[model samples]
Target chain A: MIGDAFTLVLLDPMINFLVILNNIFFGSFGLALIAFTVIIRLITFPLTRRQLHQSRAMQTVQPRMAEINKKYSDPKRRQEEMMKLYREAGVNPLGCLGPMLLQFPILIALFYAIRQTLPESPEALEALSAHLYQWTYIQHAVPINEFFLGIDLKLAPNEASSYLSPAWLFVVLVGATTWLQTKTTVTTVTDERARAQQQMMAYMMPIMFAFFALSFPTGVSLYWTINSLIQIGFNIVTYGLPALKIEPLLKSPAPAMAPALAARSAQPQSVAQPAPEPRTPNGPGRSKRQNRRRRPE
Target chain B: MNNPRFFAVGLLLALFVVTSAACGKIRQPEGWASPAVSDSTAYFFADKDRFVAVDLDSAKAVADPKSTTGATLQPLLWQFPSNDQKDQDAYSFKAVYTQPVRDGDTFFMASYDGGLYRINAPDGRGERIATQADIKGKIVAGPAVAGEYLVFGTTEGHLYVVNKNNGQLPVGWGKTGKDLGKGIWAPPLVRNDTIIVATMAGEVRAFGLDGAEQWQKRFTASGAVADLALLGGDSIFVPTLDRKVYILDAATGAQKGKEFVAEDWVWSTPAFAGGVAYFGDFSGKVYALDITTMETKWKPYDAGHRVKATPVLIDGVLVLADRGPVVHFIDAANGTGLNAVPVVNAGTVRAGLTAAGGKAYIATTKGRLFVADPVKRSVVEVGVGGGK
Candidate 1:
């Protein structure tokens, strides 16, 4: 039942649309995929923009959040302050995740769609037929040309006939653009522990996609590569060059400390001494001690 | 607890794992076994495990469970042994390609597992008389039997001539044996005293009764050749992966007339009736060519899917099925669709259309059999499990 619904909702439409786009693109499967990716990116542009805006909002409020952590010793009080700060900034902590979550379904659907578009076997051909809608244009577009730029769109990128094949070019694009997109979009975390995790992901996500592109069809990798390039473009437009730039100074603990110190020094000298407690690894205060203890690990 | 980025990282890992594992193969749609309709019964390989026999008159399983007096009800006339492990890789390209060839009282079948079985026609009980496991090559095509000799080809690039009487391979076949150079992927066409064999190496050779090559001709690029059709016992109509059908003189293997160029590869064996040859290309275009003039008699009909199934001529109508569900009936003379909507909303048919006893039987990959009476303009879908 779930399979039928999934085909009906995503696979069927994607397969049909891909076939239609293949016709429009004059039977080039690769061009159709590139066009399809562009169209999908445009359709989800609003959500992506909102997600980027939410990430920027999160970054802008990070210093204030750290200050709240310094001010409140109680865990509940710290959470309340963080929630209040988020509300005042009109930022939902999970807002950036919504679009990413939505894009997952589309990505999965596209993967299957690419596989279905140029079916190698008769069984797959039958599936392609079933997924295709009854539009006259789409019906006539059966057996779309799978060859584009010397790559058999059905075979994996890494499964290229030789090292000199164009499939290797797709692999490079998938890897490079994925890395660029992740580098531009990943938030610069303030907390040491979270920053480490974020940095790991920034490296890992692209490498994972690149590794997957090796085995996935060149057409799908083409989609991912183009999608990544589009995302990099969106990122640069949204946040400027600074989004892509990873400064050594920004990597230091100095920027995080500066904001907390600046906020603390505004208070009286006696309260300022308490600010140092927030930095202590084994600080006696509950939230400060918990956070500091968690950071070193 | 407060690390959204860390949470996202974990989720990405999980997604990678899930998608990678799930990405291996989409659910194999279903098996496609074309119906072999005899006078009273339709024998079909429903799947790897089941070879079902259905009563044509009642359009149901021959074995009626409700009416049987025995304690245990045998559902059909017979089913092949249901061994999943033995037939694990049966759905691949090497799976059964030959339609059940009935010779005398026995039916010869070549399965995907590379087993050639001789089933008793009366009961369907079978034995694997030959196997690829023993031959060291999968039998991708054939069991086209004649008289006492059964001729077939294997993916191992050799043709085997097996004795139908005792199921023993003749000495002069295969690599450790004769070695036909490349694989024979299509069933050879046997005529008179000679058998015409098309090989994966793109060479068509006619072999004499004594297993000696009579005449050989290379027509296309080295790969598998589609089954060839004989035109008036003088010309050989062979489709090739080269996207053109070549008409070769049967006597000398010389080119005859112009090459029929198609938009895509011509894989279906051309069917000839009344001087016009009908066939479909991989691009879903069906053409009716006048062999004498080497020109298309009418505009090609687009069936809107890959037409792998050979077009059959029934009662002056050219019947063909595509990879899609719909079967099209084209007017033999004009190439126009016969029905109002051209038989809309039927089972997805990949198997060839079998016209027998004034009706056409279409077996889909999903195992739905559509019995269409073109005279009546009506179609009845037979159920997968039991016949309808």
Candidate 2:
């Protein structure tokens, strides 16, 4: 049932739209895929923008987060302080996830849609008729030209007749653009372990997707290459290229921190004096500390 | 470890892995080559790449091996590109779409990889007569055999006429092939010296044995013609994706009558018997049209699923299978349901039904062969050895 709903809602519409785009783009499926990627990016712009803003806000509160970690030795106390800090800064730590998770369905749907639109087999082509709408223009537009700039869009890089085919070029573009998109997006984390994980991901994701492109059709690779290129553009506009010292083209609202967070981080710590505690009623008292000391012995 | 960035990236990578695992396999063509029966044997693709010759007599016996009438089980006759020859690249045809056309003991078949083969049906030993380099396009439509000349069209829109004996292009047919400029998905209809070829671009043209245009007036449909049927010697039934089937005069390629409209795209080539045309549309409704009046013989029977396979007339009953894979039996005269409960639980039938020995032979995409008995209202899988 879920599969039926998915086809009804996403796959069918995408397949039809692709055929229409193929007609409008002079029967080139490659151009249609590129246009499709651009349209999908535009449709999801609001989610992407929100994710960028959340990342920026997370970056702005990094210093206060570090301070909280150092002051609270207890794990629970540190988590509480972190949550409080997050609330004060108006940042949802999980906000960046929503947009990324939402895009998975669209990406998978696009994969199936691309495969259906540019069928390589007779059976696949006949199957295409079922997914298509009843429009006369769309019906005539089929058996669309699978060749784009001398590369068969229906074949994968591994399936290419020669190693030097244009399919390999698409694979390279998918990897390169993905790496650039990842590198350009600035991610901030208070923990060293998290930063290390983030750095590893920046390299891993590109290599992984590039490997995937070897197994995927050239049309899908074209979609990915164009999608990553658009993402790189979005990154440059939203987060800027820090390594190249380029400021974001668009204004970000998160750089202006909340007053409560600013005041807490601005305080001076005395190395010679004992730290003050008992800020909240649930906070550990001296009796709890005594119990900890007695239990260890 | 608790950072949202790490969690998000990890989740995204995991989703990619799941998505890739879900749909990783490259879509390979599942051939729908229907069984081409000649005498006691049925020839078809037992699998996508393996073409086999099954002894119909043995298959029927095996289907009911314990019959009180002394039926005994037996193995298949032979399979082409045998297991021993699989390592040889020359034997690989990738996928076969065109049904094999029989000429005596030999059969001619075309593959999606553009290789044309002539196999001796008695032993299944095949020779690749033409390679992909020779054809230059995938063959979707089956070759039409007319005497010593064998003609076939490619998805590249070029039609080739070759000598059945030598596999070489016949004299005056050009060095390569005659380009029709549109992909030919429907098999060309050959009647004596004239070959009628319909294209995916909706052009219907008739050419002679020497590749000369035979029709003076060109006929074009609003949509791609999926299949063509010959109604007697004077008219041709062109079933198109435009949801209308046009009856054209065979000699001049002119409209002979009003086009028969259907609820959806008409892909099945209408089966004709006694001046009545029987066919189904993609919308699952099967209609019987009386060519004398160009009107419905009866109300269209709903099979409740898409129908792509051409219906066959067997013993006064029109037998056709829907994409639902459910077989339906309609009365050839009145279009009433013949079988109270239509034959169910069959494989998806995309190949056109072949009638032989008073039974309909069906070959599915998964390479399973079935024989349906109209008398018994039963569909039985013919278990060829090592099938699917």
Candidate 3:
């Protein structure tokens, strides 16, 4: 399906229009790609908006989930409690996941789309025929030249050709930005179990995105980097700023809610209750200081 | 944070990327070059310095200009620049040397290192007129002459038609300036007043003298056009690197039918003689194909790398030059090699062979120019057109 959309839509039209534009502009593939990318972005705007709302809703539910887990200590009952929690919050946990899941098909479509615009696929003509929109400009389209901003679209980074100069840069950008995007979303740690899961994801997600950025076309990396920056902007606007505002929001108009939080903290976490006092690397230094003061000063 | 207003931002980001890409304009083509034709006068880079002009009155096939065959023939007049050495260096950079447009007055030319040029008649007279385009790089093909214009394709994949009468300013064109998408190496065809050029990407487009494209045809199987032969009614037979010769309607750019010939490759320009198209291949076999049936009527082998030279048609007999030290005299009726004219030390014709003055002028890679008169069975070194 990815191959289908790419062939029919992305690579095919871009190749055709770029050639015509090259004919008109006299062979500038860079301008061609830039112009073509804009056309695609405009067409897919509605889907992108829907996806953003879903991500924001997903972020909102994480703390509520931690609340449900604490109230129902049994795993089976906790899952039921979490469902009840979701029902009360009027948000589908799946609603948060739904947009991400929806991206699978579009991602494949995008992957194929990028690959289609990319050269060296060996069976591109057949693929192009299947997926490319039959329109004008194809009458004179050829495989694009390799001089677009010094990146060879015809070459994939492998021992077959050689590593691209931009590959490392792209990998670094992907890893760094992915780390930032994930790091900025402050998942409230209501307990040890949730904190462990969050920490695992914090390290894992960036590494996964970094590996993906390495072998892709410089154009795709450009797109992803641009997309990531857009996501970052969205993160800042919605999740990023708001996540930081968590402390301030906690000082809500409702001090009544704060009494509940104080009551919850008052209850002992376990008989092994070494959990409170904000677990830290400083261990018992403060506790030892308190004991000294308790030594009848 | 719980307010869903955050999504308005992702939509905005998409809008930004799209808008920037959609709006930016493109830059212009780098440079342009015209083709050079080595004919009777060693004509090329017309306005520049030194060039060898052959004595056509001595090369008999062209001396008598009354014949239908000799109408296109003219003397190879050698021009020596006032500064011979520098002129020779300048001549080496020739970009275009078109066939003579008038009997003795004008022809088209350009230099790969220089620019476009339109020079005077024989006697090697006057300074060269230049074109606005800075001709650059390895100009492999073209400078095809049609009517009053010098038609040619560039390394930049553009086809240009410049005025031969006026200074070689680009008069009319099909492509805006470049990316006609594929470079054209084979010289374009001018038949019944229409100008035809083929692309490296198997596209055949025809245009009027003023640059209006008559039709455009893409050969699906002919990835690259190797040669084109005009067959009236806007139909042209094109031999392609794709191993097929496609017949296209020049007016509509529609494929009439494709004739599959060689199994490996066909590089030689197809010859139209006695209503048949003859071309040789990597296998060195010359196939005589019936244009109508798309079937091979005859096949003759030369056991060479390529039969790249166009077959010279004379009095219903077909003669072709090969990669050999030999010239082939093939029976037009059957694809049999009737005689072979050997070039004691041979190379792919270092330059195109011009048979005039009742002799075949052969230039080889070894830098030897031979004048062979078959009836006498003798070849003498008339001049060396190659560099020292």
Write model 2 residue lDDT over B183-212, tens digit each, in one string.
Answer: 888888898789999998888999988778
- Extract clashing residue pairs from model 1: B157-B182, B157-B183, B325-B348
User: For model 1, what is the error of residue B31's alpha carbon versus the real structure, in angstroms, after optimal superposition?
Assistant: 4.6
The DockQ scores of all candidates, in the order shown, are: 0.10, 0.27, 0.04
Please list, in the order the candidates appear, how each scores on TM-score for chain B only.
0.81, 0.88, 0.70
Which one wins by DockQ: 2 or 3?
Answer: 2
Sorted by lDDT, highest first, which candidate order results? 2, 1, 3
Q: Which number leads on DockQ?
A: 2
- Which of candidates 1 and 3 is the stronger one according to DockQ? 1
Candidate with more favorable, higher TM-score: 1 or 2: 2
- For candidate 1, the lDDT comes to 0.67
Off by over 4 Å in 3: A1-297, B1-50, B56-77, B80-104, B126-128, B134-138, B168-178, B216-221, B231-234, B350-352, B357-359, B372-388
lDDT of 3 by residue, A1-297 (tens): 954564456445554555556546555555554554455445654554544555454455566566554444345756776665455444454443333343343433344444554433212322333333333344234434435666654333431235546445666776787677666554455666456666766676667666655555555555555555655665565444664563322211211223433344467645312233342343432344444655784
Question: What is the model-wide C-alpha lDDT for candidate 2?
Answer: 0.78
Candidate 3 lDDT for residue B379:
51
lDDT of 3 by residue, B216-293 (tens): 554443355645667644567777654567777766777775566565345556657655777676446777777667
